[model samples]
Target chain A: MIWPFITRSLGIATILLLAAIGELLDERAGVLNVGIEGLMLFGGAAGFLAALKWGLLAGFIVGTIVGGAFGLLHAVLSITLKVNQVVSGMGIWLFAMGFVTYWADRYSGPLPMGMVSPSIHGLSPMFFIALAILFAIWFILSRTHLGLKIRSVGEDPSTAEVSGVNVVKIRYLCTTIGGLLGGLAGAFLTLTYLACWSHLPTMGLGWVALALVQFSIWRPPILLAGALLFGFIWQFAISPETIYAGIPAPLPVLRMLPFAVTIIFLTVISSERFRKKWALAKPAALGQPYIKE
Target chain B: MIGLRFPKLKCERIVILTGADAVKISALSVVISFMLFGAFVAFEGTDPLVAYEHIFSFAFDPKLGLPITLHRGFFLVFNTLAFIIPMAAGIWNIGMEGQFYLGTIGAFAVAYSFPDLNQAILIPLMLISGAIFGAAYGALAGFLKGKMNVNEVVVTIMLNNIAFWLVYLLTVGGPWAGIAESTSKPLPKNACAPMVWNTPFTSIFVIVVAILVYFFLKKTTIGYQIRTLGSNPIVAKHVGISAPKISVIVMAIGGAIAGLSGYHMWAGDPAFLMIPRPEAYKAIGDLTYWGIILGLICLLNPLTSVPASIFIGSIIVGTTVLVRRLRMPFGLDVLFLGIISLVFAAFQFFHQYRIRRVKVVIGK
Candidate 1:
């Protein structure tokens, strides 16, 4: 029982990790893409449909591209036109949530036969992909010139520009990457985990990832740990019918755990004392639109 | 072959926009949003014009859709007011959805316990209790944001999820479980909201509230502070007022307004007087978001939201035609909201900046 739970938790962590890393990159670049939730929804809905028409690989690719395209739109809005980032994010969220939820219902067909996640010893291959991404992100943010560019742009676009960083390009780059990963994470829900189409299948997991970013204080390694723990939560706890049969658990009550914990975590993080103690640097210019005037 | 080439266009920041300029930008946004949605429908192999016609006619047909549309306006008006109030103060009450849920439970608690009370006392009691419950919840988030500098958006979202699940727990197999699966029995008739001329009396109350809010925001000192806070937080902070206090007030008030919508759903709407089934639970929040869209589209002006809410109500009524007749897909209402808002956000840029035709010489 323990082994099965751990493996399944890992699978859940994979989805969270991808989106978290994407968001981390985005925030690090000073573009607070609050629309991560919607991006994931768009990815999941479009990816599921694509997977049905073509294959699993196609689903992942389409999901990634779909996210990238929206990311591009966001970059254009937030970076180029300098539209308010939060509103742009909300617009994207509304559109994707609306469009995806609509079409998911229209095309509520059965999953393709035997479309399970290829696992070795009951552990998903996708978990390893997410781990690799986590490692790559850590390396990029710490060691590479592109990483320096992203952090500098996020910190102060004016300064980055003065120092010849091409702030707009870096922000655009990171935003797109974040959006692509967000979409990919959504695709993972339909293609790998549920292996079928469902309405709003992300079920606040996108928001869970947003919370994870804060909980991790924008660190890839801490985010990975948090994702694994939360993965063992609702998806693991209330999800299984037989495991908690003796406890007479009210499923809806249990479903509140993650969100409640998210609020509690946010409150704790916002406490001045805790922040001064363990806080890694949040991007100073986050949620601010860069103006070169 | 002779080719026609258009001059290059570019956007430059403008110092300020006049009223006419803002109106032009808004008008263009409406056109573009429709064109985009039309393109979407056309992609789905349907004539976009037909869909619009169906939506329009189905929305206004007196016998079938008009009454429901007007009834829906009751909730939208409150929802819009709830959204615009805090938003004008530069606080986002994303918990409108959750607050509405808490409002339902609050009203249910009052009505269930005082079932035999006379109509006058019980009705006001239920409505007041619902508002109080919603206010308490909204204030919690506002207090956290004001005191700690925590982001209200994320906090409200968490609260929304928790509130929804809490309601779900209560309705399904909890103490409130009355006679059916996933729902409760109807409240006593005395507790039901009173109607006048085939409309909930609260509809009149909402209009009065809107006018009062308009005056409060425009003419009152605290309202001045709220508007200042929304426009320039730095300048507002420099003023001697407490940010935390204002945040709490706006959110609590917004929550109170949002809470009334819960009463509207519970005892006001003839169709859904009972606790909603678990399946239809989250769908209720869809109304709150639609109101949010109206609030944003109208630039959070209280008076403007009145007509905007009515217009959106018709569109929402039209969504049924889209799904049932056109087989267009579910959530067309949301898609419409999304596209309009997205296009509007893009066009809102023109309010601050003007596009110019620039001559370009390649290969200098």
Candidate 2:
């Protein structure tokens, strides 16, 4: 029971890790994207369809590419055109939710769960991919000169520009990479973890990832720690049938565990009093569209 | 290497829109959304123009769908205002979905308990209870946002899921089942919304509320304070305006209106007269999102929200007509909305900048 729980929880956490790291990169580069929710849906739908036509591997690549494409659209709107990031993200979400639902109904029937190989410790290679990506991101963000430039851009784009950093290109590059990872996460969600696609296969996990970015305070290693805890809680709450066998709690109520936890944890972590210390280092220019003069 | 000349695209932030230009931009947004949406429909192996014909026949004036569109508009207006009112204080009230649901439960509580109460008394009582429930929920989010600085977007979103689960618990054989397990017990038919002009009387009620909200933002002292707070918090702070208090008050007000819409949507309507099944949010349930979209579309103007609601309502009603006819693809409502929002955002760019064609020299 413990082993199975650990494996399942890690599997769930991987999804969060992928999406959150992508978002963290954007935030670190002084951009806020609230549309990761829709991006994930687009990735899931596209990945599932591609997998149906091609194979599992094609699904992953297509999903990532689709996500990157949407990310580019978002980048053009937010970074280039300087549209309101939140509204643009919300628009993307509404479109994705609608399009995915309609597409799923039109093109897909009940799908058989696809199988993946090379499961180490009962976790697929997706988990390793996530760990490796997480490690790489951690290294690039902390130890590299590019990391300093990104931080400088997030803190003060004008200053960074004066320092010779091309703020727009860096922001766009980060956003595209973020979208790529987000897409891969969605592909993994449909083609590997859940093994099938539905209307919203991620089920607001993208939002949970958004919350996780805040919870981790934008640090990569800390994010990993938080994802593990979140993963365990999510797994526990998602399986009320097993957990609440003796207590007889309502299933839907139990199903809301992860969301409820997200809200509770978010409030506690982000409350002004608690954040006075941690919010100090938060990206200063985050959510502000920089206009080149 | 030889140099070749080509054209490159550029934008200047100098071209500001005139009054007429604003209207043109707005029209451009609608046209682009329609074209993009139509392109999707055409790609789906159908005649997009023919599908639109069925929609217009159903959704426009002098048709059977006008009343339904207006009825839907009433709810969309309230939802829009729900966003607009709190917006005056710079608070984003995305919790209308949860607040609306709680209002239904609140309305259901009153109607179920006093089924034999007088029509006038019962309806008013239901409305009050609904408003109270909605306001309390909204205020909770507001309080967290104001005092605790919790992110309202995530909090409201989570609250929506919680509210829906609560609905599922109550209606699905959990002490509130009426004719079926998935519905609350019916309210007395006499408790229906007072109707006039072939639409819910709430149509008039919504207009009055919108006008009142417009005045509330423009004329009142608190409105001034709200405006100042929204425009600049540092000035508000110096003026001794309490940010948290205003946040809670505006959110509560917004929530109250959305909650009132809950009664109008189902409980107080002759068509429903009780909360019905969860059809992916239990009808008019997830429609709270339409308000969010409309709030953005109207640029958070309380008065503009009314006509905008009607426009959106017609589109939804029209698309719904096409969905029934099976001549058009489903999800057109959301597709249209997403396109509208995206186009509006894009146009916001155009509102400030004009495209400039620059000549570029290339090495070949």
Candidate 3:
């Protein structure tokens, strides 16, 4: 039973882990992609459509491209145009929700048969792909010169610019990469996990990914633990039948477990005593639009 | 004999605009947004002008649209105000949706628990309870942010999901479940506030409250302190203002206003307390985002938020009409809103800077 739970948790965590890692990268580069919610939804729709017509790999590629397009929009608005980051992020989210919903309504047909069957040892191949991506990101961020440049841009763009770093280019690149990951997460959900298209198939998982970034304090290893923790809680809440069939907990209460636990964890980690004991790993320039003077 | 001559360099300057120029820029941005949206509508194979006509007619028609528009506006005024107050204190109270839900639950609990109370007594009791519940909800986030250093954004988002589930459980098959299975029983007759001149009496109440909030923010010392804190928390703290207390106070006030909006939903126009269907709940939750946009448009001023709320309210009503009458897709309003807000944000950038090109020879 415990083994099954671990496996289920990993399967669910794949989507979140990928998205959170992407968000972590974006935030490290001082861009908060709140539109992850919408990006994921759009990715899900695009992936579903592409998967139906061509194949899963094509779906994933198209979904990543779509997500990247929105990320570019955000980068333009927040970095080049110097609009407020929060508003731009929210705009992307809202636009994605509307666009995807519209597309699904007009163009979608019946689900392709056998979409729900597991394709790789009782799990989707995307799980291994996600693990590979995670290790790659960790290597890039921790071991590469480009990673250092991205971090410098996020920490202080003006200083980075003085040191000959192209802040705008780095930010745009990071944001687009973040969007690619978010898009892949959405595709993973529809093409692998749930195996079908639904309105807002990402649900509120995008927001949860945002929270996980903070919970992990922008570190890859900690992020992995956070994602798995949240994924476990989420699966447990929604699939209580798998754990204990006879206990009659209210559905709403069960559904709320993940969010409630998030609140509790946030309160604990945010305590003044906790901060005193361990330094908070927030990016110095997170969420601020850089303007060259 | 060797003389070197240098060519003048071409320079570009960015000028910050002010006063009337800023207003003109903003107006232009609004026009651009409308044109962009019109183009989008045309792309959908509908005549933009015709679509606009249908939208306005459904929103402004006295017999069909005015009452609903006004009803939505009444609630939106409170919701927008709820956002504005905390925003004035430099806090993004994204949890307003949750507070609103809790407020409705609070009001419903009062009305349900004491079904025989007189309107005069029950209404005030319900309002106070609703406000208190909302305040407490807001204060929890405030406390975590102030005392615990939590990011209010994540805390509020999490709280929103929790609040929503709690409400869902209570209303759907729980103790407060009504005969409808998805809604609580209607408030007792006497407990219901009578409609005034074919609209909700709460409309008048909302107007009065809006006025009071405007004065409170404009005239009071605490209000001044809040604005000062928002602009520069460090400076405010240097002058001995307590940051934690102010955070809690502002959030509580915002929560109370949102709670009043929830109360209005329960006892106002369609005077019944129902848990929205899942899709409806998602749409309703998006209302907080709309309120944020309104608050930003109004620059966090209560005086301006009223008109902003009304404007947004009409758009919402118009969009619903478009979907129902014209068979448009369900989420067009949200798309349009996103575009409009994005344009507005861009306009805000333009308001701050103007591009000027200077002619100069370059090569030396």
Candidate 4:
């Protein structure tokens, strides 16, 4: 029984895990892409539309491309134009939300029959893909020179520039990759997990993924843990009886648990003592835009 | 081939814009954004001109339009202030939506608890309690950000979800469950804000608050300190300013303003409290989002936010007209707003740096 519960949690957590890993990479390059939520939404709509018209493979490809495009837009706005990252990110989110919503309303009608996924050895292929990506990201960040350059750019772009790294190009590349992962995560939601396109299907998972980045302190492995924890909390909220004999509180209150836990964890990690303790994990210049002056 | 020498071209010096040039560029950006939006509307099969006409006619119809527009604009004033005040201190209080709902809950708690109070007494009590509740909620996020160094954006977003659920638990199936599943009983008549000869409670209150905020920001010592802190925190610290305390104070004030908007939303218009429908939730979310955009457009100036609020309010009213009359899809206003703000953000870059073309002289 516990095994099934854990498996279910992992299945649900794939979306968060993938998006959080993407954000981890993005933040490691010192570009905090707050528009991940919007990018994911755009990907969901794009993937769903393409899946309806063509096939699931097309859905994934189109979703990723759309997400990458938005990521490029964010890069242009934040990196090239030097807009305030927060405003531009939020603007991207609004644009994605509005545009996707408008198009989805006109296009998406109902889920076609038999669109659900077939389980692979009692687990989802998407979950395995997420795990593979997580391992790949961890390996890249920990073992590669390119990863070192990305980290250097995040930590101190001036030093990196003096060291002859192209800070702008690295940032753009990382942001686009982050967006691709975010798009893939959204595709997973539509093509595998929910198996149907719904308005804002990613919901606030993109945000939860963002918080998980902070919780993980930019480490990919720790992000996997944070995503699973949030996922289990959500599952527990929705299906409390599966674990316990009776319900604890009202469903609404139960649903608040995941968000409340995120706050508590964020507060704990944000403390000066903890930050000092984990100094290496925290990116020194996470959200600041790098201008070659 | 030997006679193919090119004429010498003079290069224009690329100088950063200042003062009037910056303003002109910003105005141009706004116009460009509108033109793009007009094109988008035209693509949707409605003549952009016709859409604009309907929007203006609906928003300016004296008998119906004037009151509704003012009513909507009044709430925006408070919401926009909720964003700009904290923003002036360089903090993003995106949790205004949560604070608004919490304020409604606070006002309703007071009004529901005291059923027979005098109108004069109950009104002030509700407003004060509402503001205090909102302040407390806002201060929670501020404290986390200031002391714990938490990312206020993430915290505020989480708090938004938490606040919605709390409201849902209270109004849906918990202690304050209404006659209907998602609504509470109407506030007592005495608790409702009294109207002045055809004007709303918010119209008067928003102006008063706007004036107070303007003076407080422009003429007060703390306000000056806040402005200094926002521009340069390192310098501010050298000058003995407490960043944490200021953050908490600014957020609290912002929360108070948003809380007042909640009170107005509840008692001023629909005159009852309900868990907003999903569509209404989208509208409220857009309201705060646009409030932030408007605040930025006004360069975080409170006095300017008043007119900005009215302009945004007119847009909101216009979108509603578009939906009702032209059968356009929902959330077009937010899409337009998103594009406009993006254009302006790009323009901010141009305002700072100019691009110039230089001719290369051969054999120099």
Candidate 5:
């Protein structure tokens, strides 16, 4: 049970970190991708099906492409048309719910379950993929010129534009990249976590990842730590063996630890007086929609 | 137009002022939502005719369908009040699920302790006790938010999980253990509210409660304050209103209403008093969220919730009839409703903002 706990925690953390990191990028580029869950579902189905046809690499590539397309739709509606971000995100969710269920039912034979795309080391191949992607994202978001430009767009799009940063293009690219990461997260869920195609399979993970951003305060490094903590709470709370093993508390109550932590984090940070004093690091234009002047 | 136009004014910020056109917008929204919902149903690969028939059979037929549907409807209505009131106060009381459970547990505890209590005393006491239990649970979240600035959404969601476990722990350990499942003992007969309509779902308690709640919202100072706070807390504070205090009160009231809703469920359908099967799920009167959705469809107007619940109730009834008659799937009804909600939410945006792409003829 403990081993299973450790493994599950590791898997959950990986997926959560991927999604959170994607969201962080989008937020940093002044676009809030609230429809991460939808993109993930679409990605999961596309990637899973692609893996069955071609291979894992093909699956990953297909997932990224599909995800990029959805991101483009988001960017066009939000960045270009200037629709309300929240509503557009919700529209994306509705559209995905319709598309994925229909697609999953129509295409494919038996859905994949139990194992991820072929293993690299003792760990599932996804573990290595996640590690490589995380490092790549960290480097791209922090050290590179493009990363600086993206960050400045979120911080002050007007200033970034004045600096000849082509804010719209950078925002469009970052949002698409965010979608690609979101797709990878979903693909990992199907190919690694649950290892199956499911209806609303992502459950509430997308929303949870959004909350995780607040928990980590948008820092990529802290996102990893936050994901691990959340995963630990989730794993501990649902382990039936731990519940029956003379543990002083019921398991369901413990399952609540992640939510409690989120509430505490939000509460501590959102307090007016506290916020006014030493402000927590937050994406300047987190949920705001971009309207080019 | 009643020969009326905008009054001459220096400065006005009236965007979407109320008129008969508002009704047209809402009516259009409902139509659009239903169309979208129908498209989703078709995509699910079931003949919706069959599905709609099943729901109707369940809602109106004198058999298992009507009784259960009515029972569910009453509880849903009861829960909606609990949810909407707090929402009006600008607090998304997602903890209604927990509060409902607490209310049910509290009602059961009281009834079980004094089985011989007179019906006159027992019924009112059960309702009050349930309300108190719910209020207490809701107050915890409110207090946390007011004192700690904790986001209500996160706290309420967590509280719901806590409520689920709390019920599990208590029923497993305490005297509410059912004869079959280890849930609460059967609710005493004397504690049950008297029936108004000869139907299973229509209870005198539900109707009386609805009226009281309506009056409480429209004709009361607390209700006014809650509405004011919900609209703008900063303005409310400037006008010497304590936003936190109103929040606490509104949440408590919301919880109490929700608790009463749970109590109604117990009285209406004592069968649910038992714990769930090998899977440890408990309803504890969860018809609230759907009721709230229906309530929102009616523009969150309390008066509208009544007819909306019945109309939505009819749809549920209609769908059940379709299910058995047409051999459609069972859970597809909910999916249809969800699609409807999504459509309704989307259409609401369009209704609020009308887009007109026009060319600017500067030279002309």
Candidate 6:
């Protein structure tokens, strides 16, 4: 039971970790791409469509490509246009919802009705791809000079610029890459997990990832921990049969405990004492648009 | 982009914008939003002209689509006004969705308990219960923000998830078993707020409440402080006005107002569930992000939300009709709306702020 739960949780974590690592890079670069949700949704749809038309690898590539494109858009708007972070984030959500949904519907082909691609077996190629990405992103963020520059840019782009770092370029690259990761995560949901191209298919995973970012807080390693926690939560709890029985209805309330815990965690993290002492070193200028002027 | 005509000179316009400017800006935004929406429809293999005609006729058709459009707009208006209140006070409660869902469950719980109460009494009571439920939820975020300094956006977003699952459990597990996954039983007919007009344009209670809110914000001392805090929380704090307390109070008030929509939606709309239906939209219980969209369109003002909500309502109605008729995929409206808003914001920036470009001169 534990191994099965762990495997399922690990599978879930792998998906989230892919997104979280990308977000970490994004946050480290000081650009909070709140449109992560929309990015993921678009990625999921794109990946599903690709898989439906071509194959699994093609779907994965399309998902990543779509996600990267959105990341680039975020970089352009937030870094160049200097739009408000929240506003830009909202734009991402709206644009993804609108653009992908329309495209998916327009290009839709006959697979099985409601199914985007048939599964290979119990697991999918995208699932394995997600696991590989988790490690790849972890290595890139922790080990590479590019990663260091990206982190420095997030930490203090002004200082990084002074120190000869191409802060703008670094940010643009990281955000785009992060978006790719986010898209891959989304594609995994459609092509692997559900094997369907769904409208707004990523659901609230992007939002949950944002929360996980907070819970994990500046640690690449902790992405796994946070993802595992979340995986255990949304997956393990609230069996449908148990709910259908309706003997004790408070199970629904119990299902909320994980989300509620996020609230509690945030409250704790933001406490004055916590902020002063244990506050994760957020990219110092995180979420602020990069304005050269 | 032109070179700075007045190089090294300060560009200052001292004229204050009147209501006319505000009206014009909003009007331009509406017009521009539609132009973009037209472009979207054209992209979907449909003729823009025919689509517009269909949208207009369907929206005002009065028999089939008008009521549904207005019914849909009711929550948008409710959510817009709800978020705008605290937003005016400088508190961004991204958790309005969670608070809304809480209101749904709370009001539903109350109404479900007293099934035989008169519509008048039941509606008011359910609304009150909604207010209380939303207030409590808002207070949690406010308390955290006030005491902990955790960003309200993150906290509220998380809370929205919590609220969603909470409602999910209630619908599936508890006393009320909704027909769908994220819905609850419809309230008794008598439990609904009475329609102000026989037409589904707007609910009477919402109109009355909006007026009262406009006056309260314009006239009341607390409202003044709320507005003041929004502009400069630190300054308000320096003046010993208690920013944290105001944040809590304002957010609670905002949640309560938002809850009214949930209460009335369940009461009046053909209730398939305790919560608003999510046939096409993915996120059902959480209306926070959409509320933020409304907040931005209305500049965080409830008075503006009235018309803004209607405009947005029409967009949703128009888009829904188009998608259904065209078999367009879900959430196309969100994409079109986002692009339009970005364009509108970008244009508005250009309209208001002058960005001077520097030019270099070669040696003569």
Highest-scoring model, DockQ: 1
Pairs that clash in candidate 2 = B278-B282, B279-B282
Residue-level error in angstroms, candidate 3, position A156: 2.8
* TM-score-best of 4 and 6: 4
Model 6 spans > 4 angstroms off? A105-148, A238-251, A278-280, B1-29, B178-186, B199-202, B270-289, B323-335, B341-364
In angstroms and one decimal each, the interface RMSD of every candidate reads: 1.2, 1.5, 2.0, 1.7, 4.6, 2.9
Query: Candidate 4 at residue A164, lDDT?
Result: 93
Candidate No. with top lDDT: 1
lDDT of each: 0.83, 0.82, 0.79, 0.80, 0.68, 0.71
Model 1 chain A is weakest, by summed lDDT over 10 consecutive residues, at A236-245
Judge candidate 5 at residue B235 and give its lDDT: 87
**Full ranking by lDDT:** 1, 2, 4, 3, 6, 5
- The best-first sequence of candidates by TM-score reads 1, 4, 2, 3, 6, 5
Q: Any residue pairs clashing in model 6, and if so which? A: A29-A154, A30-A154, A98-B335, A252-B169, B97-B287, B119-B190, B184-B273, B184-B274
Off by more than 4 A, model 3: A1-7, A53-55, A105-110, A116-118, A276-280, B1-26, B271-273, B357-364
- Candidate 2: where is the Cα deviation over 4 Å? A113-122, B1-10, B14-23, B61-63, B179-181, B268-271, B280-283, B355-364
Model 4 chain A poorest ten-residue lDDT run: A108-117
Instruction: Write down the C-alpha DockQ for each prediction.
Output: 0.73, 0.60, 0.62, 0.67, 0.26, 0.46
lDDT of 4 by residue, A1-293 (tens): 67667767776699899888888998999998888898888888898899888877888899888888888888898888777788778878877777776677566555577765667655678887899999998888889999899999999999999999999999999899889988888877777767776666665778889999988978887888888888899778767777886776768888788889999999888777788856677788787888777
Q: How much is B211 displaced in model 3, in angstroms? A: 2.2
Over 4 Å off in model 4, which ranges?
A1-7, A106-110, B1-22, B271-282, B356-364
Which ranges of candidate 1 are over 4 A from the true structure?
A240-245, A277-280, B1-10, B358-364
Candidate 5 has a TM-score of 0.80
- Better candidate by TM-score, 1 or 4: 1
Please identify which of the two predictions, 2 or 3, would achieve the higher DockQ against the true structure: 3
TM (chain A) per model: 0.95, 0.94, 0.93, 0.94, 0.86, 0.85
- Clashing residue pairs, candidate 4? none
DockQ of candidate 2 (2 decimals):
0.60
Could you tell which candidate, 1 or 2, scores higher by lDDT? 1
